[model samples]
Target: MLRVENLSKNWKEFRLKEVSFKVGSGEYFIILGPSGAGKTLLLETIAGIFKPDLGRIFLEGRDITNEPPERRGIAYIPQNYGLFMHMTAYENIAFGLKLRKFQREKIREEVEKIAGILEISDLLGRNVKKLSGGEQQRVAIARALAVKPKILLLDEPFSNLDPNLKGRLMREMKNWRKELEFTAIHVTHSFEESIVLGDRVGILINGEMKQVGEIREVFSKPENEDVAKFLGHENILEGVADGRSLNINGIRIELPQKACGKIRIVIPPESILISKNPLVTSARNNFRAIIHGIEELGAIIKLKLSIGENLLSAYLTKASFVDMNLSEGEEVFISFKATSIHIFE
Candidate 1:
């Protein structure tokens, strides 16, 4: 288990302000943030590579705020893999064990076991510089695991990987985590990665942690406008709330709950239904809008619609697009359930 309390770190142009969160024993916690969000800085601070300006970090119940990086008993796998190019894969992996003064036989046993687990046994004798990116990554991971660390800090582990490789590695990592039963804190900007690897996620923006919760909870209902926007909510509307009623740019909507004064509204693209003709369905909010743009998103079709003065996004399958004969500038009816809309202050 790991806990950070009001952790603040300032280094050069980067600052992590009041970052606080917890990772339970054997839990896979993902720190989600965009580029330049100080995710790596925060990880380094937690790893004791960078000392914090204020607050404390605890592993289980022991405070490690003042501990050195080597004394923290944590393994860190940075973005570049950090392998010695001149050394063979086996040597690179065995480096950590050597630092801990393990016997040659013991080190060889551990390194070989990890290499087999990572499926990099063939590359053990090969120089690291000759290895592919994925192989190098596996070598790095094997090195990190060589020491039998109590906690692992992964900084953008799969960022450089392609989609298919990323998926495979994520599955492999998940299985390894379960089998190894080690606590992990993975930092990434990819939503798919967070969804796949995280038991819970902390959304960081501009060095501030806006929301920390279970993946489904944070994805389905974000905590604020910024969080919603970061989560890919395209339709952000400003409205005046009157009890359970909301008026957005003259279009009145009925909400499932009541809140007063100014508020923000977020309607997910999937929640809005698009039809060629008006439906007699029970959806409370319906508007006739023109398609402003049509984007091809692999198997999905994303349509930008203009409703009154606001623009909303709708998504459907490519098959649906062909079935409906939809095109830009075409008029369609957009309907969304009142319950589908999320309102935040």
Candidate 2:
């Protein structure tokens, strides 16, 4: 288990301010944020590459704030894979064991074991520079695992990988984590990676940790407007709240809680149901909107709808779009439950 308490690090114009979180044993905790959010800096600080200006870091209840990188039982793998280009895959993996003065037989055994698990046994004798992106990634991970660190720190591990390879490697890493039972802190800007690999996630922005919780909880109910926006809530609207209702563009939407004053509401595009005909349903919000724009994104279809003076986004499957014979500038019915809305001040 790893715990960071009020860790603050200042570098140049960016400052990691009062960031705190905990990663449990065998838990894949993800630090989710956009580019330049100091994700790598935080990981480096934890790995002892940079000392924090203030606060403490504890590993299994032992304070390691002042410990050197080599003294701490943590493995850090950078975005570049950080393998020795001149060395073969086998040598790269065995480098750590060699530096630690492991016996020749033990180094060979560890390197082979990790390579087999990562499915890179065939490329072990090949030079790292000659391997593909995914292969090099496996080699880097093998090197990290060969040391058997208590905790693993991964900084944008799959950033350089292509889409297909990214998905495959994510799945492979999940299985490997289960088999290895290693506690890991993975930092990434990609939502798909966080959703697939993280048991829980910490939202970081502008060098601050805004929220941290289970993946579903954090995504479904973001702590603030910034967090909500980062989670891909494309339909953010400001409205006046009067008791249990909201008034936006002369349209009244029922709310799950009674709130007053101005507030912001986030309606997930997937939550809005679109139909050519109005159906008798329990949803409190229903309106006739014009489809002003339609975008085809692979298997998903995004529709920009106009209701009165307000615009909203809705997503549908490609099959459903074709089934309805929908087109741009056409009129349609949109409905959503009051409870599906996320409201914040």
Candidate 3:
């Protein structure tokens, strides 16, 4: 297990403030945040590249906050793959073992084994500078695994790859983790990647660690308005609470049982339903509104609705838009179940 408690670091422009989290053995934890949120800095700190001004780091159960990078037993792969340009793929992967003064035979054997697992055996003889982005990334991963570190930290490993290649490499990484049983902490801004690759996720914003939990829980029930907006909750309705209910722009919205106080309701654009007229359905919280605008976003249409001085965004299929004859300046009714409304105090 890897534990970080009150990890704080300061740079010229940004500071990481009392950040803390835990990753269990063999667990895949993703550190998610926007660009320049100090995600990479935290990873580097945990890997012993930067000493934290405050806080402790523990691997398994041993405190290693003051340890050198070499003694930390952690492998960090940076965004650029950070392989030696002058070395061949094989040599690059074997560098860690060679640095430890391992026997030539053992180094070669370990390098080949990891290369095969990462499906880069054929590229082993190629110079690192000549390999493609994906191949170089694989070589970097292979090099990290060659050391057999206690934990692996990947910093935006897929940001440079194309979408298709990113998907394939992500799948390969999952398989490699299962085969090696190595605990990993991956950092990325892509929600799709976080959902697909992470066993759990930690959200960081403005250098502050906001929330950490299982993927589903974090997405469905964020801890605050900032986290909700960061997780793609584009339609946020601010309202006052009045005993198990909220009043937003004259619309009474039932809360989720114990909800109270001034709350921000996060309704995902995809969770909203639209109709030309208020239909009698099982859904709760139906309201009539006007179509403020229509945005054609490829295969999907984004409808902007004017609901009592507030604007709500909803995504709909192009087919549904055409069938409903949705147009700007037209009257419509939007309905969303109370369960779909995520409230944060």
What's the lDDT for all of these models?
0.91, 0.93, 0.90
Candidate 2: which stretches are off by over 4 Å? none
For residues 140-227, write the lDDT of model 2, one tens digit per residue: 9999989999999999999999999999999999999989899999999989999999999999998999999999999998878999
**Which regions of candidate 1 fall more than 4 Å away from where they truly are?**
none
State the lDDT at 69 in candidate 3: 95
RMSD score of candidate 3 (Å) = 1.6
Superior by lDDT: candidate 2 or candidate 3 = 2
Tens digit of lDDT per residue, candidate 3, span 1-345? 999999999986778999999999889999999998999999999999999999999998999999999999999999998999999999999999999999999998999899889999999999999999999999999999999999999999999999999999889888998898898999999998899999999999988999999999998888898898888777888888877788887888776655666778887788788888777878777888888889999999998888889888999999999999877899998888877778766
What's the lDDT for residue 115 in model 1? 90
- 107-216 per-residue lDDT for model 1 (tens digits): 99999998988899999999999988898999998898888888999999998888899899999998888777878899999999999899999999988999999999
- Clash pairs of candidate 3? none
lDDT of candidate 1?
A: 0.91
Q: Per-residue lDDT for 84 in model 2?
A: 96
Candidate that would win on lDDT? 2
Residue 78 C-alpha lDDT in model 3: 99
